[model samples]
Target: MNFLALLLILKIGLSLALLVRPFMMAPTKALNNVMSLYGDNPLIYRLYSIAILSLCVAYGFGLYEALSGRMPWNVIAFGIVSNAGAALALTALNSHPKLRPFEATFATIAAALVLCALAPNYALMSI
Candidate 1:
């Protein structure tokens, strides 16, 4: 349980960090990389960043619900979708490779984080 809790905490930290990085924390070169993947300009990057931040915020909200046992099922569902998106992004590396290495790398890590955070107990529970 302690290990799982630790992993959860780590995931939370990483999610929040990556999600808010472009907006509040670090000024990442990721903006340019994300732009190269599927964006056109700074506005596009900001939009994308907003989406990422929103998902992370959602993840945090779900995490809280999970800990509270009131609504983990919903969060798990969202996490699964997030996982699938990441996996799709990762699989794209083998073909139609438009994303920069950093973008793909981040996607892979984000996918893994979603998987790890939601795997052990999330997959089995139902609403």
Candidate 2:
């Protein structure tokens, strides 16, 4: 019920959504057509999803420890970097007007999560 535990739960949910995005949202034809520059393949997207899945697993463990009243600093640190980077990347991608709404919304979510995590907490180590 602590704030850190809540944050970890949010992060795990986000990572799960990201991991399934390619499979659920991007139809094969769209992927092939839009990313033809990448040789009409979803390989890169799949790899990225795998990476997100890894983060989800890490966040799950962090949440477990957090519920036990332990601060998982390393997982929190990794989450900060990953979420911040995703926010920045999504923001930049929002330049494409066609994708602006989705990209901007997720970017805002990621940024807000990072800000919450960075807030003063006795459990956290130095930023």
Candidate 3:
């Protein structure tokens, strides 16, 4: 598939993983690692996941439109802003070496998503 479609699918999958991570990690040490950073409360994480999942649905629609040769500028803008913001926010967590691996992985993913969102426009400009 196209680049935008691929990025959107990857993002949707990542968001789905986030939506289930709290529950999936509950019986594992991974949960403890998260708890140490956030808190003892998994509720907050679950809530955040719900929000992300909702956005993922919206992104699905955006992807459909994009594949039809009509780029959804609004969705692209939102993706750029949200992903860039997430990447920036994760950078702050880097100070805690214990969280570096987790933060860096997602931050890198977010940054990639931001770049993906901008890439089409960049290509258009060069044409």
Candidate 4:
């Protein structure tokens, strides 16, 4: 209904999609093979997906609470990590220009969500 809700929807949708990317997009031609080399068995990749999914859920709940303009510590931490990842991706994708937008969008979305969460009307004081 408000800016924070809208941002949460974006974060939730994008994150959920990303978390499922490997499984759904893997065998399909449209799915880029760049990630295939990592294979399906790496315990690390599985852990990574779980973490990403958890972050998404956090964003969803965090933004839900953001209606009061109080950004919780968990949400702030998530934003910091998301922002850091975006910066790293932007740098890492330098050799692959096709990925430029992905990095840029992640940075923008996460930053906006962070700002919206910290706004006066949507904040939570007690963490």
How does each model score on TM-score?
0.54, 0.68, 0.69, 0.66
Per-residue accuracy of model 2 over 1-127 as CA lDDT, tens digit each: 7767776776677657644576445756766554343455666777767777877788899878777777776776776677657557756653545444555555554564466556635343222
For each candidate, what is the lDDT?
A: 0.53, 0.63, 0.64, 0.62
lDDT of model 2 at position 18: 45
Sort the candidates on lDDT, descending order: 3, 2, 4, 1
Quantify how close model 2 is to the true structure by its C-alpha RMSD in Å.
4.7
In model 4, pairs of residues that clash are 68-121, 68-122, 68-123, 69-121, 69-122, 69-123, 70-122, 70-123, 70-124
lDDT (Cα, tens digit) per residue for candidate 1, span 1-127: 2322343455557656654565443334555554334433456555666776777677667566655544445554565566566657656644434544435655554564466455745522443
Error of 1 at 116 (Å): 8.8
- Per-candidate total of colliding backbone pairs: 0, 0, 0, 9
Best by TM-score: 3
For candidate 1, the TM-score is: 0.54
Candidate 2 collision pairs: none
Model 1 regions lying over 4 Å from their true place: 1-8, 23-30, 33-40, 93-127
Best by lDDT: 3
Candidate 2, superposed: residue stretches over 4 Å from native: 21-26, 31-39, 97-127
Give lDDT tens digits, candidate 3, residues 62-103.
Answer: 878766666667777777677667656767544655555656
